[model samples]
Target: MDTKFDFGEPESQNTVYIRRVATSTLPEEIREQVPDLDSMYAVHDAEGEQLALVRDRSMAFVLARQNELSPVSVH
Candidate 1:
């Protein structure tokens, strides 16, 4: 079944580290673009992979779309 995720925060600003994930965790077509992710934030390839993640509402989605997440939810 398809699921949704909410990543949380920015790595640069936070001390907590999230779990490490493999690129395979993402969709096959965009797996290569998955960026080095931290507990607080996640980065994606510059090639719209970020946008896809956000659209899917995956954990990486939250990181890629940090601006949209509320401060309360980020924590």
Candidate 2:
């Protein structure tokens, strides 16, 4: 399997972090958007700003790339 690990360098701000988040743990407003899904992928920038919430990890990576951001998985 292909994998990547980020060392959190000075230029990490250019990278986007992808992680799985339980939908039930999200706020009511955000949870309402994905009622059918039990979990989702969260795409966050190095500064911890959420960029997007996708149905899957692959989608998160794709969305990040489309936005010209490098994506790395977090746990």
Best by TM-score: 2
The total of clashing pairs for model 2 equals 0
> In candidate 1, what residue range of length 10 has the lowest lDDT sum?
48-57
- Model 1, position 4, has a per-residue lDDT of 82
Cα displacement (angstroms), candidate 1, residue 56, comes to 17
The TM-scores of all predictions, comma-separated, are 0.22, 0.77
Q: What's the count of clashing pairs in each model shown?
A: 2, 0
Candidate 2 lDDT by residue in tens digits, 1-75 = 569877676757679999999999999998888789999999998778888888999999999889888899998
Which residues of candidate 1, in runs, are more than 4 Å off?
Answer: 1-22, 35-68, 72-75
Candidate 1: tens digits of C-alpha lDDT, residues 1-75:
578887886544422222333455655555545454321233334221322233222564456346543211222
Clash pairs, candidate 1, are 9-40, 18-39
- lDDT: worst 10-residue window of model 2: 5-14
Provide the lDDT at 5 for model 2: 78
